[model samples]
Target: MKSSESRLGQWPLLAEAARRDRLGQALLLVGDEKGCQSAATALARWRLCEGSGEEACNCRSCRRQLDAHPDMRHVRPETKTIRLASVQQAVASSQSAPLWSPMTVLWFDPVTAMTLEAETALLKSLEEPEATTQYLLTAERRDQVLPTVVSRCQIVHLQGSIRASRPFRPEYLADRGRDLQEDLTAAAEAVRGRYLQRPDPRLLELFDVLVEAHGGIDRNLNQELTRETVAMWWRQTVGPD
Candidate 1:
């Protein structure tokens, strides 16, 4: 198998940025889903790959690195927010040199999860990154990140490309569904004990089906379902039991 360093696709702008060593303070990959993160990660990997040219696309290093490489670090939230612990690990990792390549790459995905504390901690490392350390950060909303963090990173807004793969399941679908239901219940109880605003039974039933499907999103379940579910949940909860 060729290395990841050797198999990077040619993106003129990114190539120029890397060729000029204008990695700048950092790189921000803004996207709403996994597809965006993957693209951003690929770009970061290609830039840091040890191939002879801009992106050889057939080197052993490139291949291995793209699939899973020690030199490439991906930081994400264990839960909803990027906790301080994860940020600390990333910081420490950034300080180290690549185990296989000349440079080390770090990609922070779904940066929206970074809590205030985590962002503060990350600022220090981003301000003075290691000589060979480079970062590729992805966020759904650029405004969600602190200005300080954004200022230190080169903003690369990715649009339209959808990541067509799934990562490992973190939580069971039914459990997530129950959690959502409970959240809805709590919200409903908060609005002056109103029960009339309870979500539609049909919507809840659909969610139950989805939970059973275990993250397998069906085409039949359109965006309207999501909208209706949330609306019903809010309406029911606000009205009373």
Candidate 2:
């Protein structure tokens, strides 16, 4: 939607979907955090834009979304896990009509952090979606989310790392649980350091796997399983490192 193409450039399919009005009621954006958020924000703007197709016309609705409009509700985990209360609130909010815009947008990030109970509640909301409301869920890896939850949404996978967009700034990461953020940061740094040293194609693949494993961890997957998986990737890439 914005003139800059740093983040949304990697998600041409999403833009095409918006332009064609083929966007589903629920969308699951999977990939790097910043990239997913950027794409989601772009979709929100596109949906509310007055221009034909994906081109943003800088209309009042579009400007509101860019300025964090009340009609656009953002849901992120306040702690290590997304609680049931948050999911309930989201569901309740979805039932209401937009205050100013034509439709309401619910933006949920890092959905892998949702607890089983929370996700179950969200699944109900997804099953009977409101026609006037749309959902945008983001996660690092699709596998980390429940298949039931993923089933109800159109999946979009971003390929390249993009600059974080406005409205969903890096500071929002602090609200996703500080410890989890630190863990992901440390894991990324470690894998990045190794990749930088070797610069091998295989190492890059390993880094991707490691990123998925980090998402698994956020989903409360078995720690031993994660460790074994990472170790296996390490063996395959760097040979016991």
Candidate 3:
């Protein structure tokens, strides 16, 4: 584990689990996006490090891995979902020895983004793993994942990211569609939590757009159209509108 006084803090339990070879076949790390990604990256670097088994975070291998070396496979969504091809590629790579070392480290960030087919393909590999392959999977919401996959892994809940602020009053979202409510609630919580340094004029514009999306989704408008409208609005709201 890294020093407790370090900015990254210590993860003695995870370190011990890895040392004991009790990290299970698959490690499911659950947290908000930022926290999950950070933790996953740190763990991956630790595993790849040559200086210290517990992730000294100062070794040459650790530096390269954290900086995203070619040998360290990072599987993520190229589009909305993780295609079966991605899983196949990862599995194939896992079978091979490391490009730079003896161990292969694969980080499947946001593993839930994987499509059903991709996930099933991944299961086969997980069921029969190579002695040198290491897998780290992260997810924001586990309920969205397939139970079969969930059951195969050791769930490591990492409650590091800040939570979503309480949603807008249910009455405020009463007429909204489930999707719009989710979006508005996210936006409202972001703004209310003071995530932005200062109120952007575009934020007011986004609020207006969310109002419109809520109405459209509620009215059963065209799903594609509603999504596009809301996306454009969000882009403008978050961008230099």
TM-score of each: 0.57, 0.60, 0.59
The better candidate by TM-score, 2 or 3, is: 2
Ranking by TM-score, best first?
A: 2, 3, 1
What is the per-residue lDDT of model 3 for residues 52-141, given as tens digits with 9 covering 90 to 100?
444344656756635466567888889788899988987897787776644677778788888888889878888888878878889887
lDDT of 2 by residue, 64-173 (tens): 53547777778888978788898899779778877766678887777888889989998999999999888989999989989889878877656432322212222322
Looking at model 1, residue 62 earns an lDDT score of 63
Give the poorly placed runs of model 2, Cα more than 4 Å off: 1-10, 50-56, 65-67, 160-241
Model 1 clash count equals 28
> Which pairs of residues collide in model 2?
none
* Over 4 Å off, model 3: 1-9, 53-58, 65-67, 160-241
Among these predictions, the greatest TM-score belongs to 2
Q: Identify the leading candidate in terms of lDDT.
A: 2
**lDDT tens readout by residue for model 1, 1-241:** 2233222232222332444354454777665676465667666656555666335445566677453877777777787778888888877976877787776777776777888888888888888889888777788877888878887776654442122122212122124444432332233223212212554554434333323221112212343354355545444432322
Model 2: lDDT of residue 186: 45
- Whole-model Cα lDDT of every candidate shown, in order: 0.55, 0.65, 0.62
